[model samples]
Target: MLDNGNVVWDHSEPRRGANDGTSYLCHGHLARLREIVATTPKAVAWMREQLEPVKGDFEKTAPMKASSKLPISAAAVDAADETLGLLCSWAEYTAESIGQPAPDMSNTWKVLASADSTDGALRVQGMRSDGIATVDSVARWMLERIDVIATHEWVEDFTSELCDQRATNLARWPYEERPKPAKGIECPDCGHTTLVVFTPAFAPKYSTEPLLRNGKPVEVTETVNVYDRVINPGGSVSRSSRLVKRTKRYADGSPVLATVQRLNYAPPLLVQCRSSTCRAVVRESDWARMILQAG
Candidate 1:
């Protein structure tokens, strides 16, 4: 498993690559690489658009009823530029490592290839013999060669680096752009109203009952039952005996005749404190205790 909760492998079996003294990735990881390579170019394009000059007159000429666009600062542009540079560098490095043709340094590529200014006509590793190739084309080539690219560890590293860069760019935006938390809930640690609750969108419920077959209860075993004797005012009553059918036992010693599933109407929620001063969190395991304390 990786930091982003993506599991590269879940079985106990050793990989063939490892056995052969070389590294290899499972089919799933290759597919994941393909997905990342295929979608990253679009994200790069959007980030590039952020580098455009900000509109200066829109704010002043806008009507009072119209909503204004989010403010893009110099720092935001710098961050986007940095992310784009890193992506281009990674693409080039992958090409070099795999013995593929170095990416063609087109005008857009040259501008973003490095943070420093570059001459428009200067090309890196000479022009790609296959003609002009944009970042998207390079990415497509990578997708086609996904199987021979790198090991699982390399894939994980790639995923983390790109994801972290994207996260950094996103964090540059103001908190108002994110989901609005319930302000009425107070943070127990700071005594401030900054508790945010997140609940699972799809909560599952389960039920257990007697296991049935052909519309009848399937008896796993039988047990003998004895009726208790009762003492009368003048005489004693005799005890009675009978047999009782028993169902299979659950793992926890409970009887399970069958099973059913339903939606959990009241699912557990995670409570987090948004206060910078007191970054306390209450996980679902302790949610009940926290609620009791609050009450």
Candidate 2:
């Protein structure tokens, strides 16, 4: 949503830089609505799997410690459901304004499935319980009918109302939350106190050590901490975290054991300047250097 208005392309005929056309306000709401509708069922399935009785569950004689985080997952599902409700309400309102028929919801349920792209335009297929097939062509309709509605005086007012609702709903989405800015820390690159530090989403943290299991060599993998000081900028040190496979060979030309490590799996901590015009970044490896330079 933070558009910096940087020109992305230049036209040769007119010799002018094209305006930035990447605003979430344009189609972000519809895209998010489709995403939530498609993924909510998966979240529901996962919740069911966690809550339902499964094989290997702890016995009544010695119950295992319950997870304290399970309720967070349930809360996330509720938030997603509420957000979807808001979006559907907005969609229904827009459909009404465009004179589109209201879909029947009496004895049937609607589910948004995979997108249909047979006719070159991308449209989400909504299956109803009563065998009625519907296509979510809001995006296509908007593109095709933009010119027709461009002159309508109510379009601006309607757009404002929709944007207000979208902003409220988007804020309620759990995954949309971002880390707060690191207070009073000047960005090394931009020299601005707008840096936000955050952990990498899915970084791996372990190396695989070879072990003998049932007379066969097996690899036992373990994970690492982001704070591990593996990167040494000074002296002779390996620079990249790419996967490395090493074999310790016997002096008589036989391999004794092997170790596999994906150093890249544990990505460096990062700090980014939130300033739109000065989006500077610094990696964990550069933190020491930046601090020394500032000192």
How many clashes in each structure? 6, 5
Candidate 1, residues 1-295, lDDT tens digits: the string is: 2332223342674333321223354443333344445544444434434533556687686564456555544564455455545656777777777777765545543222433546544334222222212544555455555545554357557756776776666565422223246555577678788866553322333455655689887645547575767776689677766667666676898664554444322222335566544545555557666666667
Candidate 1 least-lDDT 10 residues? 124-133
Q: Determine which window of 10 residues in candidate 2 has minimal summed lDDT.
A: 10-19
Write down the lDDT that model 2 would get: 0.41
Off by over 4 Å in 2: 1-185, 201-203, 210-260, 267-270, 283-288, 291-295
lDDT of 2 by residue, 1-295 (tens): 2245322222222211111333222232222222333333332223223332245545654554686332334443343344334434544565667787544333223444436645566333322322211112222233233323323444444445545644554554423324457765688667778877654333334656566678778543334323323646575454344444545456796666644564322322445566655545455567657657657
lDDT of 2 at 218: 58
Which residue segments of model 1 deviate by more than 4 Å?
1-23, 26-28, 49-76, 109-133, 151-153, 170-295
Cα-based lDDT for every prediction? 0.51, 0.41
Model 2, position 288, has a per-residue lDDT of 54
Candidate 1 structure lDDT: 0.51
Q: Largest TM-score belongs to which candidate?
A: 1
lDDT of model 1 at position 266: 26
